[model samples]
Target: MEEKYFEISTENLKKFIDGIITDNYEVIAPTDKDGDTFYGKINKFEETNLDILLPKMSYKEYLLPKTETLFEYSISGVDTEVKDGLQNIAGANEKRVIFGGRPCDAGAGPIMEKVFNWDYKDEFFNERFKNLTIISIACEKPDNYCFCTEMQLSPESSYGSDILLKKSGDKYFAIVTGEKGLNLVKAYSNLFTETAKDKVPADKDWKKIFEVEKTKSFLDKNFEHNYFQERFLSCIGCGVCTYTCPTCHCFDIQDEGNLKEGRRIRNWDSCQFGIFTLHTSGHNPRVTQGDRYRQRLMHKFKIYSEKFDKYLCVGCGRCSRNCPEDIDIKEVAKNLAEMA
Candidate 1:
């Protein structure tokens, strides 16, 4: 693919982000809040905290919100008026720049796009994506939890990112791609300096890349296997895994208000919940916690891949890291790989 590379000093990185904010663009970056880093809207460049690891939440919320109004209705006398609840958070009206995002988080955008655009196209997600520019920072020091390599992804993978930045010495090498990325480079031309053609920084911390193909092969034959129950017995049926995941996009729609008027709202939902697949007759297809957990694994590793030709997981390892039961996805994948 055609790409343009430019180098910018570490000191000038703040100025580059500040310039985007000054131009009336919403700058969303990793911001420190209560000792935890989260992707939040930043008014100034100083508000961003890039030193932390991956944020507790993914950038999916920016694209598909946790809670959004679908439409609003009002009634006066015998007349009723219905209005569309349009979303303005990072849409055509206000442009967005996601800076200092991890590559795995950046990669989630494309995977989620496939699901959103499947049979029924979602206009809200489509419009906001067009107006957003992703500026992802390559991980310099990945911990044991990082397993992007297993998913055929890495700190350097620029799958869904517009611009990928990697730290090299005292400067950051920016690899520009897509129309929005090139436009940013042209606008802030002074901040970037032309670098050597062959200069590319290496991610030293990422050493072990798991055998994903082997794991997929095992999962292909183990759908009805009894191992799933034992594997997920310790799971507490919490929705933390789906909530922190970047590609989990299940949602529930509910209408709120009295008989006079009401508003339909869409909120994030998870497959781990017992009521997620419950029918109106009080019959739940996934009855036990193990059943829910098995569905989660199958959806991520088998079902989604069979339908979309891509795995639902990006291997960011947040699920494994935050799991109270210490159910490491990487270990599970490795066990499956050994079975094959």
Candidate 2:
């Protein structure tokens, strides 16, 4: 279907969201919590905090949970029985609407989706991704940490969003980019005006800080470069960077329970951890923090791109903004570009 444009007043937009909630769709939006903004479930439109550029964490958790059960097994004497864990997930089939995320946050869904569907289909992630609708608002005032433009994504880009909303005075110029968005507009026809808003408001002037191609080239040639070792000296290997990153998808599987019964679960894991590559024989491949950090950069800039043809990063700046050591990824990329 061809893309369509419509203008919706702020009043009507609120009503539309409220209508979605009334229709039994779970609405997730940025909400204030302890003076920090985080994505959480909202019952009404009034709970959404759209003023923030981005949330502390992306809405990825809603799709790929921090910890998910994969399967369950029980042992009876010498016989064993296994059961699928999909039925154990609460709200696995619920329809969800992710509203007011930034373009970077929305762009991360597709990037992660590629990995989930790479070799083996991840039914756990696919179930949530299929039921979710992303409605991202374009950024008008980005701060120093934002670098979405460097990753080939602009504030107004609708790459992963079903609907992209740009603020224009008291109304929003909405661009429906896919079938989901078209169906949404059709359902809420009373809220959206027929009068088309042809022109979307201009995006903020977010300058490209570094050339990603040059950074990729640098990584491709210099895997053993001392830059990675010397630069991340302050990195305490706390795994906070991976936790806050929108595109980090590494995980570890563990079995829990006694001999009678147990469940296999997938838990979020980080390469930044020291024990991540620790073998059972006690010889770890990535011995130092620098080695672990280099793996992270290589995976994001070089390895994943070579396989998927898309960088495993959206330049949301959450990893840098939330870093206790204040180590910035944008700066690292810029430095690599200059070296190249």
Candidate 3:
């Protein structure tokens, strides 16, 4: 709290995490079980993993939640009735500390805040965000399609992160961005020292490998372009990219089970699928795979920028990582720019 930046020894990083866990803080980080990424309350700091390279999915799964029950309903006779059962987040009373979130993953939180709170104030999202404190880990290298710079976002982006952490040498350099971040550091002041000059990322420009401007230009010029027959021709229409994208915030609301007893639930959805924009009247808005594919790029570059004045794509390249169809976003962006 003395200065904005503080340093803790690499040796103490795990210990500090353990201490947070001891304080009843739900410490969530990347963990592997059968080579699958799972985030849960870590019982020990040793459970914190930063060596997974790139997680196929973003950390938004924890904050936004994959499924949420709006309420429960039951019918008596002719009148259908519903009762509120869920949608409660004990923010003030609950505390969360999320660690090892990449800049792209962490930055999506603030961007999502606008839409979730725009038309109607979503108390559920706001509560989760308020109670949650993020500690973003700076990325060391750029993935194939990642152009964080295109959106003026970087591996060092401090958007939703309460505490920013950079791995420098054997130590981790940290900075507190909000009151919660400060309190967190203060809670474990003994484990940390005053801001150390030696704890800065040696190669701060490590992300220069990805061409941000080139990617943006490609996206801008390809507004009227359809990537379907070209780059996405081999795409199996799998919604893997949407699931991997940090900024892809689409969900489906469904009422399942019998009409007498039902519940409204929200589940993660993808624009890549034909059913995404399907209307109840049976007229599918985005019927073609090409249209769905183009929507993905358009939403990231134009629509999101128009709405939030910020590009939605974080350039994490998770889409490339998870694409079973071998769709490469970097090549697609570059090809768009080159062809134009």
> By lDDT, who's the top model here?
2
- How many pairs in model 1 have backbone atoms within 3 A of each other, for residues 3 or more apart or on separate chains, i.e. clashes? 0
- Model 2 compared with the native: what TM-score? 0.95
Give all TM-scores, in the order shown.
0.95, 0.95, 0.88
Task: Name model 2 segments beyond 4 Å from true.
Answer: 75-81, 89-91, 195-197, 202-205
Task: Sort all candidates by lDDT, best to worst.
Answer: 2, 1, 3
The RMSD (Cα, Å) of candidate 1 is 1.8
2 against 3, candidate with superior TM-score: 2
What TM-score does model 1 achieve against the real structure?
A: 0.95
lDDT of 2 by residue, 117-154 (tens): 99999888988898888898988877788888998898
| Candidate 3: tens digits of C-alpha lDDT, residues 121-174 | 877677787788888888777655676655577777776788888887888788
Error of 3 at 163 (Å): 1.2
Residue 119's lDDT within candidate 2 is 94
The best candidate in terms of TM-score: 2
Deviating ranges (above 4 Å) for candidate 3: 1-3, 74-82, 85-87, 196-203, 206-227, 257-260, 280-282
Of the candidates numbered 1 and 3, which has the greater TM-score value? 1
Measured by TM-score, how close is model 3 to the native structure? 0.88
lDDT of 1 by residue, 1-340 (tens): 4888889998888889888899988899999999888999999889988888798888888888899888889999999998877644434535689999999999999999999999999987887777779999998777777888778688788889999998878888998878889888889899998766588665555455458777778878877777788888888889998999998999999989987899999999999888999999999989887788878878888888989988888989898888999988888887878887
Q: After superposition, how far is residue 161 of candidate 3 from its true place, in Å?
A: 1.4
